[model samples]
Target: MKLHLKAALAAMLCTTMLAAAPLRADNEPAKAATKDTAAMAATAAKAPKSIDDANAWVVVGDVKGFIQKVGEVIGKVRPGTDTSQATTFLGVMLGNPTIGDLPAGSGVAMLILPNGDNIAFAELPEPKAEANAKPAGFALPSTRAEGLTIFGKTQASADAGKALAADVKAKLLGGKRTSSLHVTVPFGRILKEHDKDIRDGIADYIENVMKIQEAGRKMGQPPSVTTATARMLEGEFRVFHKLVSRIKTVEFDLDLTPDGIRTEALFIPEKPVAPKAAPGGQPTVSDAIKLISGQGAMRMAMEFNPEAITTFMEGDLMAVLTEMGLTKDDLGTALKWMKDWNACFGGAAAFDMFTPGSKAFGGQMIVRLRNPETALKMLESMPEMFKASGLTKLYEDMGAPVTIEFKKNAREIKGIPVHELRFNVQAGNVPNQLAASMKMWASGVYQIAAVDNWLLYLVGEGSMEEFIDAVKAKSNPGTAPLAAEKIFGAGGYFYTDYNIGAAMKMMQPALPDDPANAAAKAALQAMSDAMASAPPLLAAAFNDGGRHKVDVIVPLGFLEAVAAGAMKAAAAGNAKMDKAPATTSSATREKSPADQCAENLSKIDGAKEQWALDTSQKFGAEAKWDSLIGDDKYLKRMPVCPDGGVYTIGKVGEPPTCSIGKEKGHALKK
Candidate 1:
């Protein structure tokens, strides 16, 4: 009933016992993977929004007054390098995006601190105002911080101790103080600098990551973008604001206190957003997709299908594994993903990478950089622990291997980078099943940062078959390979159904497009991309770890099954070729009567006998060379013996040239 993707997948397998669809016999038809299909386009135009998103919190008008009181208490929480506040803020925002409605021309409140940490609150632009800020989930003021303890400060006595005179030292404890207080180092700096307490604070950041990591496991781990925001009131008109441009993770602990809504957020350091390309000649979606997923070699068969993909998640997922060639044991320590993945990717850009040779695999650092480059570079540089590791080796050592090919797909939306991408991912066979079962392998949009490259791609066998179908359907080529293949052929990583869900979540509150809302519309459009899942057949191959070429796309299972069938077919065929003739030629030879009579005739006629002997000798010598080697070499000069052998000798020191020896061969003694 819950549009869970896991359950729906059971009904739609990429491969089956359905009668094999025949290929077109006509001229080779060009296939195009355009996102122009009416069905797919509609879904992209209106991807599904969250079930409760409509009623979620909307912070419109100025709620600065309310936030200030809250900030006072939150500030007392010295979350120095701690992620608890980050998670709490992320969870609250995720549970609800609207925090009271407001009219136009207003801004969120903000402030900065000496330590570069701050709080931010919202006050929507003026004109429209709505009250009843129905804060949902565990309301902030109602709940308290989890495991909060008494925090105390230590007195600094180092400077005072040093400033004492020799006489005072003798009176106090017989120790001399030579330095003046002004010249001596300030004691407070030492107390705070690298203090055991300061390092201890890092636990907060760790705990936050752990919390969000747990939440990600609960949610789907789609590409979710997280920002650490400390919402608090600053002065009257403004709310102090500080946020990580990108958060790599998030989770909420509502059970500890059962009442406390504790959230953890792990944010990526903010960097300048990429500059978008200037407006150029506009292109159609098909053309853009074509440019991105060109030829079978490099094509970007993109679509934005949410409903079709959501059908895959259903039932208790362990049942799904029986079909996918996995067992309960495969899940390892992460038996419950509903709670973990939900929290991980239930936000902006929930990202999971299936790259070959990158550190993104292996450990669970979950580094969600501002952009893909930062994430890539971090892994690229982390191998310094070894004697030597360059970018190439780093890629080789990763859990999931990846090689990306970029193509210009979409026009830069308001000068932001929107390139199409295809990653040569080395994933297992039938990845969708694994995605449902394997926590480590599954990736959602929540962890994702903006992908600069890799729009269209191909992976393992027969993947391109599905893309070819989508392209052919949209482009409506005269010929198509197979109806099944047409729907899902080419394989590579594209947005998952859950990912589309996340995409729609971020794309929520689609602004009304009008003359006055031109800027807002631009912002909305800039953030949105019309993406869809690659056909199931194609998607399965990359997941299946099989080879895929355009029309020839095949799932690993399909290929293996076909190979076994072919081997049987070939074995049957070999039995038919073994029935040929054994030999050839039908001629006979007779001995001359004169030869038979020669023995007796030799006594009577010497001259005639001598002539016959000379003729026989000449005939035998000429036939000897032709009978043995067919051709003569220098070794042919050797004399022939009566014994059916010819003898030629060469020194052992000199390389003995090949020659037929004139002797009955006998086994040589070792």
Candidate 2:
């Protein structure tokens, strides 16, 4: 991967807070600066005591102290001269003095309560001037003195929204103590001011880091490749920076229940508003989505406002793509393909796919099409297209001629006229090894039908009947349709729900019985037992303003149960440690340390590989000679070098040897 992409990924691993740069403050606060401290104290005091018993707590305040602590721990553990690139990069980030110079009152936190509710907040501080500053590879943006606060309401009820709004206004805006879970951040100004610097620093790192460049060459990529990649991302950065630079604060709320966690994000435009279209002209999602009714352990659904998406893609995205070297003709061709594909199913589309859990591992998907005839025509042309595109040759080279057969009324699926598209890898005139490999491929067959401008494609054999029966029941057992409002309300949404425990159970048979995984297997078994009575989880994400809001709802008691299992495992480990005796090597002294070292050295007669490694391990375990090897008395006494001559340690692969000048040393009996 490019160095820029690696840096971006590394930042993600650290914290999403990197998405929001720090705002600057001019000077350190004095005794008169009671506002920030008072705010923290009041928040802490008013926080619900129940939060202490939460399943998990994530706090992001006091960034300076956090960085310092991280630095100290890392400095202690950092390898001396054998520095790896990852450790070196980490050092660079930590070595930056600005990290330790983050202003006070700059932090964010989230706590998940036992009752399936969560509270999150952010209290960011602006940046200030630096002292004894050295040039750093990266920089963060500064913020205004007056930070912003916002509130999120998870419950769909009007009363909940009202209560949350009122609480936030009273406590945060009015500067009074309130128990609302309101979040604060100066989101807009920081991104706007330092956009250029952020992009430049990132680009510079990707371009100039010699280790990163060398790594690219090792991976068959050219130097400056990461820099070029970062340059391509500049357009996206500019667009995102423009959007975020407008907003002041963002609040997120989630209502977690036994069913799932749900939240709504209302975009009240602060900068400008575009007039709404007439009701007739306004677009709507397809009711064909209702065909998603089915019974399964896994579920996913996605709905989109095609017109709105198309407009954005053709406008802003097209410009960006052009800047990234996509020709206008290429863009036009891609847009045309998308339009043609959409036209096959009218303009609107929704998709639902799921799996029936168990060792069978059967799965299927249903697509809401708007024009069945167009879709059918498109499907009929696919084979020829595959042949024309040389995909047939590709498949044949893999020991298969991709074969498709149509069967009418293959199985009963509700709310659609269906035909089965049975396909498989046919090993026709291929190498023996390739034919053998083809046998391992899973069934490529899928049932297909165009029902009222919609397509139902079913894959896997054993789950088809269950899927049909569930669909005919009229109530989809899956969580997707039940959460339709949550999935489709904010322009568009994507959702996934599954039984993790059941899925893992299905995978158990395939797992290898390795002793290394003994502890993990036990933990998983315990978790599975816990999940027997626990509810399934659902996760979803959608766009709110320029930001993407992600919501995940999991079983309330699941984590607590996992924690209990972990404690049990830890206790078992401690008990084992306490009861266990010392190792045999330590308890029984078969020989002196020098004898062991000599025995290891005597085995290295140039016939064995890694002899030096064995010698080092034996020496390190048996003795701590330090610098005493230089002493004449020690050399004479050392069994490995008893000649009283100078003993020299070998290079990585070579063996250690002793040299005796003007005298012959004892030779090996062999």
Per-candidate RMSD vs. true structure? 36.8, 18.8
TM-score of each: 0.18, 0.46
Candidate 1 colliding pairs, count? 157
- The sequence of per-residue lDDT tens digits that candidate 2 reaches over residues 395-455 is 5544457765556556555555556665566775553334544533443566676654446
The CA lDDT of each predicted structure is: 0.25, 0.44
Worst 10 residues of 2 by lDDT: 149-158
Model number with the top lDDT: 2
- For 1-670, candidate 1 gives per-residue lDDT tens digits of 2122212221211111111211211232212334433343344223113211111111112222223323332333222222223323422332222323322223221111111111122222221123124245322211101111100010111121122222222332122221110011122322332233322323333333333333223333322211111001111102011121122222111111111111211122223232223135422223324221221211222222222223323332444445334565654333333222222221111112222222222110111122355334333332231213122233333223334443442334333433333334443432232323333322221111132222222232222333334333433232223222234343322322112212322332333322323444443333232222212122211222221112222233333333343444444434433332222111101323222222112212222222223222221112222222312422222332222332222211111112222132211110
Q: What is the number of residue pairs that collide in model 2?
A: 14
Whole-structure CA lDDT of model 1? 0.25
